[model samples]
Target: MNLSLEITGLTKSYADSGFMLDNVSLAIPSGTIMGFVGENGAGKTTTIKSILNTVQIDSGTIRLLGKEMTDRDTALREDIGVVLDSANFSAILTPGKLAKVMRGIYRQWDQELYVRLTDKFALPMNRKIKEFSRGMTMKLAIAAAMSHHPKLLILDEATSGLDPITREEILEVFLEFVEDEHHAILMSSHITSDLEKIADYITFIHQGKIILTAMKDELIYDYGVARCTSDQFRRIAEGDRLAYRVKEHQTDVLVKDRRGFGQQYSGIMVDQVSIDEILLLLVKGEN
Candidate 1:
């Protein structure tokens, strides 16, 4: 399978914070939307910085579109569109003026596409970026990112600061972008619901480590939460337990093969797990 982005042992650290990214590794396949998820300060931003060459890593390798990433890979960068949490444009420049600046920077910048997206997102073209609301700023950033016709899009909290309706509109545009089969996205967001809606695969990180990387369907359908009494929980095989938490009189165990466990333990209640629940269980539960 063709990979849009690949990272192996991508390690980075600072003197004060210790390890920010510890042996981090993941892959984004072509035409796939990979949800990069984690709690705050879980190294998601660090990993992204490593991939973008914004931060020098202490160790490991990063490959973008099959080529090893380098500090001076401007050619490779042109094919990758990025939208970080904050807008990175001059506050005085309007969207119209920013488009002209982008046209000079990106060889493949599409002015028409930029205009359409700005209009679709209801971003005002007449006002300076400083005067725009947080949502409008984010929309402008996304519009600029898409106008470049990038093969791979990297979005860090791109849907943040938007109303539900606007978020849905942006999500639709993202879904349409990946329909071309040549495009891929690596979106990092705190919004699990957004990821659940459109991500093909989910890679969850915690405390500078990857907890899980699996298909969205497999995560939702194959894995489950088995609620059982403490006695019943003790009877379960150690290998079948992914994570567990003790309640008042019961224990909720996360199992990888829910159906198999269900067949084996008919008395235990195997409940469907949502991405949010899975994340909570994994982060808070014990193995």
Candidate 2:
């Protein structure tokens, strides 16, 4: 399989805050979306900054487009479109002027595509970016990112505040972009429901460390939460449970297989787990 982005032992730290990206690593394969899951301070943005080489790293390797990535590799960046939590475009430039600037920067910039995207998103061509609402700014940013037809997209909180209809429209564009086997995406989002819709893989990060990485279907379909009394919990094998939390009268355990656990422990109730439940279990529960 062709990998669009690959990281190995990627580590970084800040002196004053003492937050470190400890041994961070993951891979994004071509034609697939990797949903980066984490809490606000779980090193999601830090990891992304490291990938962009905007922050200096203490250790590890990062490869983009099958080649080693460095801050100096300006050429490689043209192939990757990024939308951070907020739009970073100039305040004074209108979408029309911004398109002109983009035309100067990207050798392969498509004017027709830019116009189409802008029109589709209902962005005003003459309106200054500073005058736009948060959602409008976000839509303009995304439109700009895709105008040049980048092969990889790195979006952090890209879909956060958009309305359902707009989000659904943008999501369709994303799905269409990856129809070619050479495209891929690494989207960092708090919206698990959005990830559930489009992401092929899910990587969970907590406190600067990667805790879990699995196929979306496996995490959703195969994994489960086993709820039982403390007495029954003792009967569960050590290997059977991934993590567990104790409630007042019962214990909730995270098990890898819903059907298998139900069959093994006949009376214990094993229910299907969602991404949010999985995050709660892995972060709050203990083995």
Candidate 3:
């Protein structure tokens, strides 16, 4: 498989907060979307910044489009389109002027594509970006990112401010982009529902450490949430559970196999788990 983005032993630390990305590693294959999930302060942005070389890394290797990341390689960067949580567009520039500015920077810039994307996103072409709402700014950023014909897109909370309809439209555009097989996306988002709808794989990070990475379908169909009393919980085999949390009256367990666990236990309820619930169980449960 061809990987568009690969990180090995990616580590970074901040002195102020003592927050560190501890030996983080993952890969996004071409033609697939990797959903990066975690709560606030879980090193999602830090990991991305380290990969982009915006912040200095203490140690690690980051490869983009199969080339090692280096400051001298502008060509490698041109192949990537990045949208962070906040876009820093010039306040006075309209969508028209922004297009002109980008054309000067990216050699592969497609003005026609930019125009079409702006129209599709319903962005005001003539209005100054400072006067636009947060959602409009985000849409403008996404338009700019896609218009350059990048091979890989790295999006950080890119859909936070948009309404449901707009989010759906933007997601459709993303799906269309990844259909090329030479294209891929690594999207870090709080919106797990969107990830559930679009992502091929899910990677969970907590407290600056990777908790798990697995296929989306495997997690949805094979993995399960097992509910049982304390006695039944103690009876559950250690090999079957990824993690388990005990409540006052019920013990919620994350089982590796839903149907298999049902057959093994006979009476304990083994239910399907969502991506969000998986994250919650993994983060809050004990191994």
Candidate 4:
């Protein structure tokens, strides 16, 4: 399989906070949607910035589509489409003017696709972006990003500001983009519900460390949250378990392998945990 991105031993640090990422390594195969999950300060955005060369890394290497990207190879950026929290647009320029500007910047810019997506997303072409609502700006950003038919997409909190309906719409656009199996996406968001639906793989980072990386479906099904009385909770052996919480008479345990435990603890009830729940449990500390 073609790899869209390969990052190895990635490390970054801030003043007095130690490394934002320590010995972090990840590979996103081409055409796969990789959901980057972390708490506010857990280096999700830091990793994205590092991949885009927007931030300087203390150590490690990142390769995009098998090409080693460096500060000198700015031209290589053409293959990447990035959408962050805000749109990279002159607030004064209308969407039509913005499209014209992009035409000069990207060699493969598709005015037809841009116009089609903008219309499909109902983005006002004549309105100044400054006057557009946050949702509209995001729609425009996505349209601009996809217009060039980039091979790789990097999104940081791109869906955080959207309503459910709009979020679903944007997700559909991502799905269609990767349908050709040559496009890939690296999406960083606290909104795991969106990731749960569309992401093919999940990478979780916490406290500057990679807690888990695996297939999204396996994450949901292989790991589970089991509930039992406080008395029953003492029955299971604990070592390398993911998470657990206590509430009065009941205890909930998040286990990595549910099949063996489920059969052993037939009296306990096991249920699938959402990405949000898994993140919450991880942030609270290793359980």
Pick by TM-score: 1 or 3, better one:
3
**TM-score for each predicted model, relative to the true structure:** 0.97, 0.97, 0.98, 0.95
Q: For each of the candidates, give the backbone clash count.
A: 0, 0, 0, 0
Taking the tens digit of each residue's C-alpha lDDT, what string does model 3 give over 1-287?
99999999988989998999999999999999999999999989998898889999988899899998889999988899999899668889999999999999999999999999999988989999999988889889999998889999999999987889888988999999999999999999999999999999999999999999998889999999999999899898898899999899999999888998999998899999999889998988899
Q: All candidates: CA RMSD in angstroms?
A: 1.1, 1.1, 0.9, 1.6
Write one digit per residue (lDDT tens) for candidate 2, span 29-97.
999999999988999999998888888899999899998877678788889898899777999999999
Report the Cα lDDT for candidate 1. 0.91
Candidate 1 shows a clash count of: 0
Model 3 global lDDT (CA atoms, 0 to 1): 0.92
The digit string of per-residue lDDT tens for model 4 on 123-161 reads 888999999988889889999999988999999999997
lDDT of 4: 0.88
Full-model lDDT for every candidate: 0.91, 0.91, 0.92, 0.88
lDDT of 1 by residue, 151-210 (tens): 999999999878888789889989999997889999999898899999999998999999
Indicate the residue-level lDDT of 74 in model 2: 77
Off by over 4 Å in 3: none
Minimal lDDT window, size 10, model 3: 82-91
lDDT of model 4 at position 214 = 86
Name the candidate that leads on lDDT.
3
